[model samples]
Target: MPALPTVRRLSLAGLALATTVAGVSMTASAKPPEPAELSAAAQVNRTIQGMSLEEKVGQLFVLFAYGPDAHQPDARNTTLYGVASPAEVVAKYKPGGWIYFDGRGNVQNPTQVATLSNQLQQAAIGTGLHVPLLIATDQEQGVVTRIGPPATQFGGSMALGAARSTADARTAAAITGRELKALGIRQDYAPDADVNINALNPVIGTRSYSSDPKLVSEMTAAQVQGFQRDAGITATAKHFPGHGDTVDDSHTALPTINHTLEQWNAIDAPPFKAAIKAGIDSIMTAHIVVPALDPSGDPATLSKPILTGVLRKQLGFRGVIVTDGLEMAAVRQEYGDAEAAVRAIEAGVDQLLLPPAPAVQFNAVLDAVRSGRISERRIDESLLRILLLKLKNGVFFEPYVDTAKAAEIGPAASLATAQKIVDKSITLIKDDTKTLPLSNTPRKILVTGWGVSTTQNLANSLAKRGAVTTVAQTGAAPSDAAIAGSVAKAADNDVTVLLTRKAWDSKVTDKLGKQRKLVNDLLATGKPVIVVAVQDPYDIAYYPAAPTFLATYGYAAVSMESLAKALYGEIKPTGKLPVDIPVAGEPQKPLYSFGHGMSW
Candidate 1:
């Protein structure tokens, strides 16, 4: 006697059996598949077999379109893609995935995002292969998070680094995944695996967990567990072969990673290795050139030696390999839109993200396959991985999210956990004058910073604690009048607190100089000047003579509240430095070592 599947059979001799497992179907001529054979691979393979060449090519690229409404066509979008709307785009290309960009109006709120996702799926279901698209967004949390308000804005990866708790990493990823699930988002291009060694790294500073490779690896692995295993959403570890050490932005131009093979193994390999071991669903390739990896001047996105030889063969990564934005200058300068797609596929990439003209690229790849420039077998290899991702992400069964439930599961749901992360992450860098804990009152406190609204909110937090506060939004490189006004307020107030936002990394002309003047001006007013760094703890390195200092990894709502609480001793500072704050004029010695923190 053999165990039979809990499925429906229509006839005895020639029954059509419908299985709950992966929606598998059994024909009358075929015997039931073994338990192992009944897994999603079989169904995914069947899906591949049924797809046409056009559908197959479409599945290889993750494209983007304009407008908040999926059904309503934007005039520019129609002329560009020749597709009336998102639904029209889906029906035309039969793409493998779609990326959500907030600035492009692809996402508005939970309900709107959910509607967009469902409409995209509806279009896919109505098309050739009827395969659900793998939806993705850069919800990296903290600084680079794509979805705003209503979405739980956890502190960035650097905050996670400061907390020094892998448990927090997992929990944060879980909470983020839950919210994304509510809105029908299935993939997160996050848990940036780049070991941010460059202090001047403009793009990945707050995004990378830490400068320490081991710390980054631990946090990366734990986040994978949180995102994929616990939260049930696909998590992609990105900018492969390390985008962390470069000072230049890959979006604008190509950056070179000048590490030797041994150095690369030490700095850049740990986090990606950890990600692979933890079973990350996808790995996004960088657009940077690593001379040691491939001396051919090819970025990782189109480097066979990097993507196929190193990541696939050396690292033994069997999951999907996705290219970072194809429209980015790093790749565009090297190859045209269509040629890059062909090159990426040949280089062993599974998904092409954000091609400028998706249709043009799609047709190019299709033509390549027909001309034997790319093989159909290569296409299936990538398609199989993507289909598995779809399976793991639950597109086969739970294709749509309950739009009503998404509102309840919005940012409010994760506020507690978010506040907890920031609370545990705020660090008291120094207190030269012992002016900390503000003595319960300070006649009046002036909270002046870059963002008018952000500083006002911090002031509001203080006022709630029975302290009178004034706020000034000193725009970057504050004018002489703004600085004089702040000094005058400092004279009126017992304590003047100045907030700095990445002042060290400012590209604005003499931004750091103006800030120093403002700080020294406030100090001259005979008030206990407290400098609070709202983001990028390194701001204190420039102001060594400051009376007091605090580091909140981000300026999110929770971070602001936590910063205020830490100032007045309402909460203890528990954060540690995740990266070194270099001593000015001495890059060799740091003003503060990694994990350095002074707690009360």
Candidate 2:
């Protein structure tokens, strides 16, 4: 939102070089050295060589945005949004790139995505800079996926982690990477390395892998390898130092992590460190406060002690450091416009994501450099990293698909992969008394709870597997109809399968007191009450009364399909619970711990 500082002075040679590099022809008689006409490496070298202190500092600032507005006839939204197009931000922004929160138009298939990305890269190349942009998205899978539809949708980080096998995790990542690459997306802001430490953490619930750092580390590595090494997309390990423990959402405000530095190092930092060691290209900073790490009490985005001292110096992460989002409450509410950008850069962050207005922010960064608020050398450091990543990703040299070809790919691969993972990851936790493997005979079954039936068609696949009567509920609260239906179904049905889909969120905990009462009441009927959790395994704590309990970790269509198959004995329940579902409020911890599952 602030203007960049003006260039104080450039040597005659530097001006000539910049002009020449910009492709402005000079007279033969007065030809300055064509330093800019050199190769990409040469241009970078020349730019670094010719830069006035101010020009170099401006390079570190990266603006964030959604897709370019297709509504504008002139297509002038590029400058306004900080990206010429959604894809160009990643291809041209290079080491510093845009973090996309939302996009214009539809992103339902891989082909459209690929075409959009190809166009984006073309714009970057046309800019005359060899460096590729670092395009990023928050594709955590399950509840969060930027490229949905035709793309296969894995349940979530936890669902993948529940599979426990690194192979499974890697396969999921590889699938994600392949789909992303097909669509022209190069950066995946995923494999959320956060361990879900608190049940009340309103944002990171299903997004996180597990509360166990070791499991999170393994899954993070697998995902990184799958996206970067296998699929040729850069993977970012995010919300560092870890955001799983916080009860607040950074999008609205800063959350505090009260753990001591020792605790964080032991519990939270391992997954991030593992991701970095696994050659992850970037690490996204969380807008959270770790009072133990930064006693001054600033969010990690602005905390030098955390960003530079801990993540850089101690952890030795040499990759690009990205801020979560500049417009987030933690940043916007705390610092003024120019100051936020300056502090983040000085704090060692390589990119500023989703700034309010990119062009304005870019100008402000330029101004900051001129004013000596941000050092030119600091800018060079980030720019170099970005260029290096572009080189590594082969963006400068590789040929990408055009828009037409991209449209043809669709999202079939993604959907198929999602279906596979869901089929493999759904586990039957306990089927005591052998209530599962339901009879093929027609029988009325009551399916009640949140996410049971939605416009998304989550329950459609399940209904095809057996005779199912569906009832929709909302939130953590169980509906009266759902409760009454469960009771009524138990009274007359040959079998009663009370499928409770808990809506996943940071604010909701495992102990569903009201829902538990309903399950207990259904259990009182002395009929087979099979409680299926189409969300987190933690919900099992609420329905201990049920003879059979299942954890699917998601309510996506694929998950529902897989759950249906498992119920009919079409597939074995070999998947494990990825996180510890603590018992009620006792905090006995581990009603069913990580890696615990039962075979059919």
Candidate 3:
């Protein structure tokens, strides 16, 4: 028989027919089935048939740990705040999944994380569903990783891509997965497949692999495979369609990508398509607007044309589809929370990620279903997918991690692996005229900008080789006083190294106007200012006159250490620009271009 029409599109009589059909199947089943004998789909269907409207609705919404009111104790008797107790909300709502955030005053430790995961799973089973709940963390690596303390910190996606081969990418992902799995995290929302088209993109700069879709695809697939294979963890290829080309941050507001569908297919979609084909378990939708794909101008999270039409129909993705945090400004500032949840689900998102409030959002989904705005069958479709994930991961049979075995894996092994990948992936973009390898003799060196202080534990690795003097730059205003002081000190020494952080892109070009003027002033003083962009490659566009320029593509400690070593000739500048740096007035293209690093 043909499937009944969706509830929203169906009349009351149609609903009656659909309900009757569903009831008949349940009534026909006489005996209780064994857990091992039940297929994941059957288990999900049976469970869904038993849930109340409220419980079914609760399964669709994932609450944010850092959102306001998230700390309040849930009526379900689950703990709600801090990394040590993340499962409290999950236990309370029997939520389909958990979305992690770096809490304000909570420190994340392995014991705490393991405890939380255990509790979440215990809670899911307590619901009598006998299914494991999804435990997700934003371990995007580089700037967005949530696991801190003893966990190894590698440079983000950009630095990993800067490695000479895709093997390094795989190794990095393996390390990420090992640590996350050790902590009992089953899902990693990572392997950002966004093509870094706009240098000004604030969030994606270091998080993206490279501007080249082919390279990103290769590296993304490698990382996904590594995460799945090494850790037995499900990996999510994220910000689907793509978020790399946009100039705005979705957390603040919605940014529009002007590319037509054809352009998107050629440049932005390859990495995602590649990852999906490689069996990536999930894909997270972006909140940005792609007018060509969805002329409605709504963010992709709530756009049916983009989610169902393009991603599902054209791309043939059968895995779960998760939305970026619904509390982000893109959704909350406009549609409000309840409307956003409805639209996201109606648009085909299986999970409403990081909802502002789990209970309120859960109630809203139920209201939508009861009002016939969203069909209960639609809810079942998503629940079945979630259950399938749990089954595939063996969550039903073996839900808890062996804490004793976890202790054996230890943080030391993972840290060593992370350090190795970080060391290998460091790229030295430029050391022109043999200007690097500074004399060991004490020299007056000036270091300033984004990551100058070695006091930060994260900054210690980058300051090992230099006699560093930290200087600060005021917005759009050159530091004449500091620059003059540094120049005078350099005149008294054999060599003067002026270190400054580079700008990420054009949208924030004016923010670095002061630093640009400082570089020019240092150059005029006849001093070779080796400007190392300790962030993204976009910084090169602002300082064309610097005699020696280097791009490290990240701000991670190891990346900083690599930059410092490359500066004084202790190590050769062997890293290449992973993306093109466009010239001034010539389309503002990249300077050294992707794969153009120099080796001594």
Candidate 4:
């Protein structure tokens, strides 16, 4: 990556404030096309002019891989392409991009990641046209983060949204961009623009910034500016027109969202519009079916009316349209991998991300163009868009990044800012019994939870604040005997603090039921109990009658520290709920609505 000039290296928050006060006098949109853009456009036209049918089709397929390594001999090697070394796959197939996935088999340190990126770029350079690969990953931060340890870990979208400041959102995204750029990754499938109105939305719960469309729009726009302008990386606002309203995870099953165009316009479409106005690099297609857009019930990933008509014509987003992973059950169960890949391109998606079988899908798309099923002109159009994105980001000029900088940039500047975000996002939903501040007059405190570290952190913090603190990790969703023993143990303390974490998936409802019973048993003891939900805010809805409740939105280290402070009353709990937590059966009746918070 090209090193930015020191004069232009103002922190993202400072740049945001400066732009706000002075009225955004300088921006990529405001300035004329740089020499790089002009050169890239000419180069793309020239390259496209000379490409064969197969070579042009290759530019549309962006496959998934773990790291630089080949697939091990195991049952898990499911993809048809890239079973060998990634470099060999690139040399053979010549893909336009590569998507990195973590935790399966390939995990590397920061230097290793930088080296792998260099290897991948070199492989692309070896191929004809030398179009630098668009290397990307799910660097959405918080729990969904891919590259880490060396990379700075910030809170997710909901945590930033709780702060209710665009500047804060900008800063968080900019910092994330800086870290990603250092690692030689140019594209981030992040800043989820989904308006999480449904508390039961499994995949998008804490990933979404807020349920309020206006706030989601503003924060998403700020994040786009931060990632693009401040970090010089491409930002993709995803799961359009919105994936937040559905109760199902697209990875598991096809989810249907039955919103009229009026409702869609009001809630789901605004953030994407704001993202487009902020000049986002791309918009990823959701697999969910929206009956309002396409009555045929086609998922957005394969719906021409939705992608070409609504996103392209209505929203006017001309940058690029990328598809979510095609292997996901939402699309795979309905359509074959190769068939879906071809249809996705026909439906107006510029990039096909993470196909189940890359070679088969690539050949299917190639065959489509050759047989006139997909016109050569269509192939050329997508090729130009892909090449132009490469040029716009200067990936052609500086495909490899500084290994030393990759190791050094993220941590030194990000810790304090991350801590501050966590502090501002810890919401105190209720303290009705005045259980908070935990009675300063020297009392025994028992911190018990499913998470050992969370319980220990609270115990440690309380111990520092003059209370004798003890902790127990009552094995998450414990059995009746385990729950009974933990409850009996809790009776020894003057006050009991229960740390709870909830999953947004309906499958976990049974597990939450078990945890709820434990909470009920704790409360039945008649000892003052405070519930700290360190993850999903909806945990409060499951245990509404707890004496006091707090929501941290996540369990990042900073969140834990900030939560401890909030518990000890060292800092006031000022954070507000970014989403509504409705009653279990009734979606309209919220136990604690958005923006609800309390302090002692």
Give the TM-score of each candidate. Answer: 0.92, 0.82, 0.83, 0.90
lDDT of 1 by residue, 256-363 (tens): 999999999999999999999998879999999999999999989999999999998899887789999998999988787888889999999999998887778888
Best by lDDT: 1
Compared with the true structure, all predictions reach lDDT values of 0.82, 0.68, 0.68, 0.79
> Candidate 4: lDDT of 582?
89
- Runs in model 1 lying further than 4 Å from the true structure: 1-39, 411-413, 506-512
The lDDT of model 2 is 0.68
lDDT of 3 by residue, 106-188 (tens): 22566666655665567666766555667778887776777765666777888877775688788778877877777667789
lDDT of 1: 0.82
> For model 2, how does the per-residue alpha-carbon lDDT over 336-447 read when each residue is reduced to its tens digit?
7667777888898887876765555666777777788776666777766655555455443452655554554435665675677777787778878887786677666655
Given candidate 4, what's the lDDT at residue 320?
72
- Candidate 2 least-lDDT 10 residues: 1-10
The C-alpha RMSD of each candidate to the native structure, in angstroms, is 5.7, 8.3, 7.9, 5.7
